[model samples]
Target: MYKEFMQWALSSDDSWAGLILRLTLGLVLFPHVAQKLFGWFNGPGLRGEMQYMTTKAGLPVWLAVAAITVECVGAFLLLTGTGTRFAAAGIFCLFIGMILVVHAPNGFFMNWFGKVPSGAEGFEYHLLVLGICIVIMIQGGGKYAIDKLLQ
Candidate 1:
């Protein structure tokens, strides 16, 4: 069972589609991770993010920490094409939580034009990311991925 699971985890094809999806997801998420963890790109740093997550978002400290950790580790894994499924799954759960907790009330469209009265963004971005993650999970890391080495 362990062997089978590991095989499934490490499995990937040589298609460029998987490679493109993983890389795109990783690159897009990295900046957000950097903002939350390191305060880059005008993002709230760890302290600010924690406060928001716990106080405003109402997430427990541990869950908030886990989410941040997942984003950080998942982005790295996605970028390197290592443990692609695991990384994609982690990110997938995180986005689902975001949509449920925050973006659901904002509706489907993003606040691109500041037209919404609430000024809060919608779940479209989260949906897109989730879709990408799902693809990566199904396809695995493609060409040049370290997962290929493991397999």
Candidate 2:
């Protein structure tokens, strides 16, 4: 089942479109990780922001590092088509964790307006991204990707 899906996604001869998808996803996600790592774009920055989140969330420090690497560094790898599958898989895992830990509290509807009994959070958006990354992980970045050229 999985292999078939991957073959389908990579079936596109229009490598440019596939490349665009890979680049967009990778570039867009990096900022979120950056906020925790470098505090760029008004982000909280790693030392204070990430540490605080780790402390509050009762997660380990390495978890923060892993998330940062996957969302930022790994995404860059995806963009460059270097280890595309590995990077996409890493992102899939990270997004799944976020859906469970962070966004799940927001609830499926993403109704931060105190809906779903509050603290319900949401898994909707994070899950969506996770699914997409999972697809890319299995399919690869398509023919135009650096991964293909490397092969």
lDDT of all the models against the reference? 0.94, 0.70
**Per-residue lDDT for 54 in model 1?**
96
Candidate 2 lDDT tens digits, 6-95: 444334343565576678787787787677777888988878766765886667888877777668777788778666777777888887
- Clashing pairs in model 2, backbone N/Cα/C closer than 3 A: 103-122, 105-120, 105-121, 106-120, 106-121, 106-122, 107-120, 107-121, 107-122
Tens digits of per-residue lDDT, candidate 1, 14-101, equal: 9999999999999999999999999999999999999999998999999999999999999999999999999999999999999999
lDDT of 1 at 45: 99
Candidate 2 lowest-lDDT run of ten: 5-14
Model 1 root-mean-square deviation: 1.0
TM-score of 1: 0.96
Error of 1 at 82 (Å): 0.7
Best by lDDT: 1
